[model samples]
Target chain A: MKVLVPIKRAVDYNVRVRVKNDGSGVELNGVKMSVNPFDEIANEEALRLKEKGVVTEVVVATIGVAKAEDQLRSELARGADRAIHVVADQDIQPLQAARILKKLVEDEGIDLVLMGKQAIDDDANQTGQMLATLLGWPQATFASKVEIEGQTARVDREIDAGIETLEVDLPAVITADLRLNEPRFIKLPDIMKAKRKPLDKRELGDFDIDVPTLEVTETRPPSGREPGRMVKDVDELIATLKDKGLV
Target chain B: MSKILIVAETLSGELHPTTAKAVACAQAIGGDIHVAVFGSGDQGPAQAAAEIEGVTEVLYVQHDENNAARAATLAPQVVALAAEGYSHLLAANTTTGKDLMPRVAALLGVPQVTDIMAVHGPRDFDRPIYAGNAITRVQAPGDFVLVGTVRTASFGAAGGGNSAAVSDKAVDAELPSHTRLVEQKTGGGDRPDLQTASRVVSGGRALGSSENFDIIFKLADALGAGAGASRAAVDAGYVPNDMQVGQTGKIIAPDLYIACGISGAIQHLAGIKDAGTIVAINNDENAPIFEIADLGLVGDLFEVVPQLTEKLG
Candidate 1:
């Protein structure tokens, strides 16, 4: 089985995000960048599937500018056999991203698509399901565990009340949740080997992927988290809550 | 103008609270509000959705045993039912809703705006981004016909003004059969789920160990609240990832959120911002958590927790 894993590059989880002075988007002045956290889980799971012989090849895919190639190399270093880079700066949203990816999947004859539930930068949590829709394939999101047997995938998902088990056939999309697996750090030898792995890049125009602007938008600082007075004790806390009618 | 559709989801043949929230948002958009449902069980949630303040008609699209699971198989089924005339489609931004709605948006080839706190003007929304550190006003693409909304604590939950009429319009969903559900082995905990509970008590790495994390559990028990954790607590191997509440983690909006030992980061705050009242307890005097706290305490969690526990004890 061929496994296609989608990865995204965004600001490091540790760095604080600030609104751009010009207000177009986030201010990326000087911040660390890394693969979106949940994507790491998907990558690790895809690699494990290959190791267990459940899958034969793992193809890592991403949509971004040229700079995102570094993250693609990192994914290859982590264990993907090859990479597909859809190069474009279309300011694409998750739906458009899914459209572009659906074409890639059909072109590559991908049997399964593994992705993070959401990107930390936008936190939209839209791509996997969106791609599943575009492809008319079954999808499972926020999956903590995925077990494959024959042409079906049995997954345990982390929901609000209790865990729900879902079953889907092959040619499905599964988004990784946090407990899926712990991501592995790239060892030095593997890093050296990854440098030699070939990365193939294709422009969005090359594939004739049409992306239209979805929305006119501006970003602003998150609202309603103002500072409050510190309470001295539980009594004060209770009193304040009562005064605020929050208890 | 065509009406907006709301997918009222259910579990155990009952209406989940988020369904009511979705109904309310449908009402807020005000027009002909249509409620849709699936599953083989009773129409409890659909009936409930119809009764919501603004939902006009409840449309049931339940299939046979072939698609009993609420897995991604429900995507095509949902989009097909929603294929009729509708100006926009609204779904909760919860786990199941997230899995299904994006696929619906993809099917429609429209722009899907997620995690929307508010729908400002028609075809426009205000949603949080950058881990809730910023708000983006997005004008959706004209070609697509669906828009999804998020639970904004009060926005959707409070739009309960409509009484609905239940209708059974059988649909040929032809949902693909799902894999069989064998078993669900879950952790043993008396606490309610952090994402759905009205109140939550969270701990940070400052709790030191799992045993110490129990303090928050006891407090949560006393308050009948759910237990949550910061990424620090989860990354330190103090708790499971399901309990981690943040941007990358579960995004929750409880009525009351208590932070013990946590220094609120932007990501953490994003999940808890819609919380009605926030109380923070941390040793650092200048922890960022205090900025968002409706109430705060500066002290060591290890010492403070035991005292608070004993006092309640």
Candidate 2:
């Protein structure tokens, strides 16, 4: 089966996201950018499925600007067959981005769509499910384990309470949770091989999707938290919680 | 006529906190409310949702395959059914709600406010941005409607003992999943979910040792609180990644959150901003965790946590 993996490029998670001193928006001038952490899991899952030969062809796709090719090449180096680029900026809302992908999925003839549960930037875990709905396919989100049994798949789903067992047919969208797998780093040999891999770039408008007309009217730094004061000792802390009836 | 449609979720026939919270948010609109429920068998999940006050009727989606909601499948059906009546839609801001509700939003061609803590005006609502760091009261574009995923921790569980009549509705949702799951390595540790717990005991980098985190765990266990860690604490190898609570981590809003040896960074505060009552424990008097903390304890966590645990026990 052909697997379509969607990845995102966001601010490097390790960096402390700070608002610009001018109060415009996030300070992104010199900030590091990496593939969304969860997307790495999606990439890793695709590679693992390739190892089992269950997923015949694996391709990583992203809906972002031309610079996202940097992120896409890394996925190819990590071990994807090729890459599909839906050129746009990363700031578009989740549904708008999903709409661009909905138009692109038609030509791909994909059997399954795999991606992270949510992009770290927006923290909106909607795109995969939204894409599935647009395509009238099934979705197994927050999947911990995925196995194919003939035409059906048995899935172990991670819920807030714990995990539950589930099943569904082919042509589904699955979002990778944090515990899915640790993504492998690309070696020098693979990096050289990735340069040779076919990287296809498609304009968002070519698929009959309008570039969403939206803008960040105003963006500012998040509110500040006051510094905590050192008390005399532990006794005073309990005394305070007790007084507030919180303890 | 416009109304609010709800899908009250349940597990193992037990009422989930999110169900009541969703119902409560729906009732705040002071209009007709319709709830749809699905489960293995019986009206246990349905009955639990119907018990929430002001529930007009509970629609039981009695398809055998409707045991768990396949949102991709149900989104179209809900749009068709709900379009016949309601203008607005509502669900709890939960893992399931986050996963499934937006599918319906996408189908309806509306932006979903996935985690609204409160609602005001006719369709406008209030939601937190940057992980509850800033609350924005937004007026939706039009009758396009607002899908409010209520924050479960922020709203108290509805309890009016009001159970309405149960009616069955057939839903032949043809949703089937292609990706198959093999296994799950659940966090089988003895700890409550950070969202559901009333009290949370968090550790920071000052803990020094992951093994030394036993004190935080012990304190949490004694108080029936959830155990959490600052990003610094998790980075310093003092706790598991699941225990990390911050903007980039998990958004947690407990009734009482105790920060031990933690100097709260802005991102960390973003995660716990909605906590009803915050208590910061640290040696530094000017720790950032204290700004939002209702109660601040300046002391050595090593000396303080044991005493608090004993008091809790």
The digit string of per-residue lDDT tens for model 1 on A1-247 reads: 9999989989988887888877788987577888888998999999999999999999998999788888888988999999989888767778778878888899899999999988888878888987887787877778889998899998888765447787788889999987889999988888778778877888787554454445747888766666678888766766676676665
Docking class of 2: acceptable
- Chain B TM-score against the true chain B, each candidate: 0.86, 0.85
lDDT of 2 by residue, A1-247 (tens): 8888889988887676765666446666788999998898988988898899888999889988788899999999999999999887545667777787776677888888889988766566788887877787778888777777677666766665556566777777888876677789789899889989999998766754442222333345445545444456566766766777777
Query: What lDDT would each prediction earn against the true structure?
Result: 0.77, 0.74
| Two-chain DockQ for model 1 | 0.55
**TM accuracy, model 2:** 0.82
**lDDT tens digits by residue: candidate 1, B246-297:** 8767778788898999988777887788887888999898999998887888
Against the true structure, whose TM-score is highest?
1
**In candidate 1 chain B, where is summed lDDT lowest over 10 consecutive residues?**
B65-74
Best by DockQ: 1
